[model samples]
Target chain A: MSAPKTTRAWILSNPPTDMPDESTFKLVEQDLSELKDGEVLVKTTYLSNDPAQRGWIQKGVIADRMYFPPVEINAPMSSFGIATVIESKAADFPKGTLVNCLTNWREYAVIDTTLGAPYVTRVDPIPGFKETHFLGALGLTGVTAYHGLENVNVTKDDTVVVSGAAGATGSMVVQIAKKIIGCKRVVGIAGTADKCKWVESLGADVCINYRDADFKEQLIKQTEGYVEVYFDNVGGEILDLMLARVKRFGRVSACGSISEYNNSSPPGFKNWFEVIANRITIKGLIVLDAGARWPEMIKEISEAAVSGKIQVGDANETIVPTAFEDVPKTWLKLFEGANTGKLITHIV
Target chain B: MSAPKTTRAWILSNPPTDMPDESTFKLVEQDLSELKDGEVLVKTTYLSNDPAQRGWIQKGVIADRMYFPPVEINAPMSSFGIATVIESKAADFPKGTLVNCLTNWREYAVIDTTLGAPYVTRVDPIPGFKETHFLGALGLTGVTAYHGLENVNVTKDDTVVVSGAAGATGSMVVQIAKKIIGCKRVVGIAGTADKCKWVESLGADVCINYRDADFKEQLIKQTEGYVEVYFDNVGGEILDLMLARVKRFGRVSACGSISEYNNSSPPGFKNWFEVIANRITIKGLIVLDAGARWPEMIKEISEAAVSGKIQVGDANETIVPTAFEDVPKTWLKLFEGANTGKLITHIV
Candidate 1:
């Protein structure tokens, strides 16, 4: 195949006020014909959307910051994706090889293998599953779901409770906690009835809609007793509510705060004293924290997926792939509850 | 010495709304006749006061509760103290032995050694340290401070910041972090200038008075970079501030909340999002969690104190031993900020 003369890329025009829109991003053409030594060219297949993108675009940077740099204005918007290697000078990557890395939302990526060694991963492509699962149910995203539960030390007897249960990572967690981990009960809190049902189908013992007027009461009644592990994806009042119901020595992992991501002054957590009283451990986990030794996690997830214990996106669905221009709107669909399982844009 | 026929005791009239005052507790005489099998009678020497007492008496018992039971109304208040074994029916404890246990606030205690095995400890007094050091620097109180820093995984490279650094456990934490752990820098957050000096004299590299108007600015300037471990004793705004300054993968130990013990409407924490942003870990620690293995901690603390590297209470001071009736007033001194270092009552 002839090497592409130009790569269509998206750059941040300005930081969004609350959430990103098309205006926040500008499309630009980049020349990628001349490749440097040890550089690999890859065509983007599936662009993964994550809540962490909001943190990347925020105006005020948190102290200490992240392992990867933020998506700077007038620069290629940073993202993670699976891609097909079209050209390579790197020994590990060859023509037509599929790989996963920080693939920008563009047609192709020019990855320098030296700096990208930590993130650039070769995809084995688990049989009987969509390639997007490499970015979803059986990949880095899957490792995040698995590691978050591991942080809390989930047990077979634990009544594991998770918020944002219908979303990508949360849904994966609910399934793994119930099926593979053999937890006593896996309860999920979602935003709507449809979302709750979708979560329940994934083997959750019960799913409570947080939108309900008596949400806290419903949660207590559903779980029967204190929660041993709370895998929280949505922070704010939901986190405080779970803290109230946490058992002694309970563990909580603050994986994401989709609920509070867009708000400046998120609600104050009132039940924090409960953490001290119960000797609970609350930890924050970034997916990137599952570093270097991902082969183990990838293997764990792939085995689960292949053994019929995990679910990925349907390959049989009638698909109208998201257009490059619609990427921002498709990303907004994540925060708006437009997708059920894994939300991704198929560029190929 | 002959066994006492009756012991003077202080009992709770009712659980306090916030801080315990004179009216909240009552003085009475306890009459004892005989000891049963496995029972050990002890003459109270020094009743050690802890901020956890307020938690024990709170109307809303924190979930998971405490290692010891709460002080009941019209009953002897629950507390830990140093006592001399006056009479013993248990083989483990002999007469004249200095034992540490939940002696309550009384002149004499009848301890059941079998059940007390988890808490009641026999201390081989160090040659030059005051007996009160068994409660102050070398007892369970000291274990709290030691283990709280241990939770945060303090390293030689860590810039350790501690809140409530002049209080009993807090002061011990400062000394242990600096002198024993050899952390890069030990910055203490205390309330008064005098307390700050006391903390500094104990080997803190820097001490900031959180009460000062420019406290936050001073903290930022002194810390220079992110704090790797925040050993928190006084939770509230100070805890929030330290959380904001935590490094990526930094840790925090929620040991005590003296500031919020008196307020039902304690100020809400605003910087909790920093926990996620920094991937920080916050864990609550109870000394009892180190059950059946305190000998190691006691040994570590004793060695530190015996080497003149740690301080207990003063042995060369004109000290007015607390009157039995003034016990309630004396305990209140902890919250009033009227006392420095170890706050205890001598029930002679």
Candidate 2:
């Protein structure tokens, strides 16, 4: 295939206020270059929209400052996506192989494999299983939940509480803690009533809507005993509440502080003293740093998915394959919490 | 020996403000109870006057929010001390042995061992060195430093930064990281010029006075590269500085927030966003919970002290063991930074 004249992509034109609107992102077409030696051309099949992406677009930079350089202005929004190899010059990955590419929200692109981007492997593309699991349950979010639980040494009989329970990472954490780790009880806190109920349906013992007037009390009552392991996705007040109710030697996995990510000012916690007095351990984890364990985590998650133990997306769930022009609008929907479960846009 | 009719003790009438004065702590004579079954009678020898004790008294609590019952109006002040066994009814502890005891600030006491009261142990004493080592290096502070370093996985390549380096635990941390862990660069942050100099003498690669006008700049210059392991003894601004300079996946052993412990309203860090971005791990540890490993830590510290690999107290240091009536007054000196290393009161 001759080099495509132009590829469609999305860019965050401006920071969003309140819930991010479609107007914040602009879709544009960019000229494509011929694939060079050691470079592989891949067509985007599934793009993962994460809560972290909200923070990424707002500042036009990734939060947690993990990435050395901030995302440049009017650039194709970069994220982790699954793509199919269309044309390949690289020896390791040949044409027709499906790969996980950490790339921009574009229809097609050439990737330099040297910059530590992992290729997809060992995936059987099981029938009746949603392909988006490669981005959600079987991908970065799943691996993150696994690593956090493992690193914090979550065990059976431990009471686990997770914030952002409806989100991909938080949902995976609840499932992994309860189903995989054999934790006795798992409590979830989510923003909306529907999200809370959905999390509970995913085998969570208890779920609380953080927006409720008596949410704190509900959380305390649901937890019963002090929380042993807190998988924190939302920070700010939710984190402070978890900190207040943390037991001695409690472990907090600070995955993503989605609550404060969009704020121009820093958020403060009132009960940070619990960190010292209660001997709580809080650690931050980025999935990119967990590259070495991806294969192992993928195997575990794939097995669970194959066994029908953990559900990714249901049959009735909508799989929208929007044009590259719709990428910006899709992200806006994500930020507004209009989409449920996993939201992906097919590039081809 | 006949049971003593009365014992000497110290009492706190009211919590002291700023630096503790002689009037804050009053010595009093108290009646002693005879040892019952499962009880051991202890004669106080060395009373540990720690900076933590000063902070604890000023805060009027041990852990935050848990008031120490206000020193019980006119009763003897409670403190942790080293004692000698005079008589015992317990099978584990025989008579006439040296032991570390957490008890009242008094000359003598009858304790019930079954109820977890003071008891004597036959462990090897502080190796013909200063008896005050029991209050400093061989005691709670030493064990704290050991466990903090161990739990955080401090290594040779790690640039370890410790705050409150002139204090008991901080001093031990600097020595432990240098001698045991063989950490190449260890930077210490202390409050005063003299304390910074003393920390330098304690084998720290660099020592910065936090009170200096160019404190943050000095810390940045001294560390050069991001810190890998930060043993935080003083939190607040010092902790904030370290948080900014910690390398990705760095480990922070939160031992004490001495800077906040004294403040009625402790200041919180404004830049906790660095925690999520850098993937930093912060763990709080209380040495008392390290029960299973205490014996091993004591052994390590003791051996190090014996071989002079780790210096405990200064060679020319003079210790004036204050009378039981002088316990509060002597402890007050800690807040004023009057003592050099370890300050102990002789109850006998």
Candidate 3:
């Protein structure tokens, strides 16, 4: 098949002065070059929209070192994506294979051995499963929640509290605590009543809206035994509240700090000594840290998804199929609290 | 010998509105009752002056619980101290036995089975060690340092940074990392140049004065390769600075926050995301958490002390023998950067 001469992609123009908006990224049709030998040609299917996208647009790291290089201005935004292998010269990556890779916010990509080992991983689309699951529930979002829960060394009687309850990872953590760990009390912290309802649906014993003025009182009343594990996806005051509620030797996973993403600096917290006096373990995690284990996790989450144990938010009901150009705008839905489960950009 | 009819003690009058001073506690001569069965009457030799004492004086906890109960008003100010068992009615404890217990800020205490287990553990004075070492270096100070280094899983070649390096726990952490773990580079953070010298004498490879104007630049430059472990005793901007200097997956022991002890709420930190991106583990520890292992730690630290491996500050030159009334003034020295090593009150 003749390769397409051009493709559509989104490129960052300049760092946002404040909150990110449509102007932050410029969508354009770019010229495509011929695929080289030992390379695979792939058509992007689904793009994962995450709060981490804000981190990428700005600086993903501090001055000392970087977890990974940030997206440079004028460069096409690259993130975790699922695609269909259309053509392949690499013996191992056969044509028709579904793959997950750092596909740019573009329609097509050509990856080779130089693209590095396991970066272009082959993914199997499970029968009777939504293909978007490969981008979220069976992908980074679920894998991250799986890890956040794993970090706690959860016990059947342990009480687990998860912040950012309605988000992708938070929702998965709430369910996994009940279905997998059999935790006694799984409390969730969210921003709205609707989000709380969604979190409760995911098996959380109690869901408190942090936006409420009585959040602290509500949190104390709901979690009487004190939290044994805190899955913190939202940092700032929400994390502080949970810190106060954590039992001695409790585990906290600093999965994401979405609340602090808009601000240049972290806000003050009063209960820091709680982290010390309680002997609480606070850990930061990156899903990519679980590296080569991705396939194993995929299998596990896939089975869970098939068993109807794991749930996800697909962009189908929210986005129109023909309006692919509006994909960049979909990212805003994450920060706006409009999207549920995994936010995805459906290309086909 | 007959027990005294009355004993002199310092009692908490009320919760301090601000920094702890002589006014927070009231000295009183209270009536002493006869010891009950299983009780041991002990004469206090030393009073531990710690930053944690501030937490013990306030509403120790937030709402639900506290790691330790607050010092009650109209009662003796109870904290860690070493004493000589002058009279005993318990089988495990004998008269003249040197022991460590939650002795009040007074000249004597009566402990029994009802007083709880392990709170009044017996200690044998090492042949060549000073008795004061039990309240400082070889006691909770050394054990806490040991646990902090252990949490990081320190390797021989690892570089470590200890904030408040001249203070009790901080000094021991620096020494233990160097002498026990054989860590390659041990960096210490102290307030004054004199304290830095003392930390260096304790085997720290380098000691930086946090009060110095160029301290931040010096820290960033000295830790150019990044620190594998950070034993934080003075949390605040110093913790923030070290957070940026920590290597990926590095361990941080929130041993204490002497700087924030006076504040009702902690200040904001700007580089907290560094902890997340780097996957660093920040743990708050209470030395008592070791529980059954305290005896083993005590034995090990005592061995190190006898071998002249763990050095201590016994106030041989600084503390005058006749000034018993000046005991509470010693605690103020910790915040004022006046004392070296462990600040202790010796009752003649």
Q: What's the DockQ of model 2?
A: 0.31
TM-score leader:
3
TM-score of candidate 2 to 2 decimals: 0.79
Model 1 chain B is weakest, by summed lDDT over 10 consecutive residues, at: B311-320
**Lowest lDDT 10-mer window, candidate 1 chain A?**
A311-320
Superpose all Cα atoms of candidate 3 onto the true structure and report the RMSD in Å to 1 decimal: 3.4
CA lDDT, candidate 2, residue A332? 54
Docking class of 1: acceptable
Q: Which 10-residue window of candidate 2 chain B scores lowest in summed lDDT?
A: B61-70
lDDT of 1 by residue, B1-348 (tens): 567888888888877666667877788998876899988899887888888888777765643455457666778888888888888998888888888888888878788878764368886767877777777777767888887877667878898888888888888888888888888899998889988988898889989998899999999898777878988887878887787788888888988888888876666555666777788899988887776557687777788777777776572111337877787777887788656777878864
Top-DockQ structure, candidate number: 3
Query: In lDDT terms, which candidate is top?
Result: 1
- In the order shown, the candidates' DockQ scores are 0.39, 0.31, 0.63
Tens digits of per-residue lDDT for model 1 on A1-348?
688988899888878656667788888998876778888999987888888787777665542565457777788888888898899998888888888888787888888766653378788766677777777777766788888887778879898999988888888899779887889999999989988988888889889999899997998787555878899998888998888788888889989888777776666565666777788899998777776646677777777767778666572111227777777777777778666667788774
By TM-score, rank the candidates, best first.
3, 1, 2
- Estimated TM-score for each candidate: 0.83, 0.79, 0.90
Candidate 2 local lDDT, A154-191, one digit each (tens): 89979999988887788888888888789989998887
lDDT of 3 at B289: 75
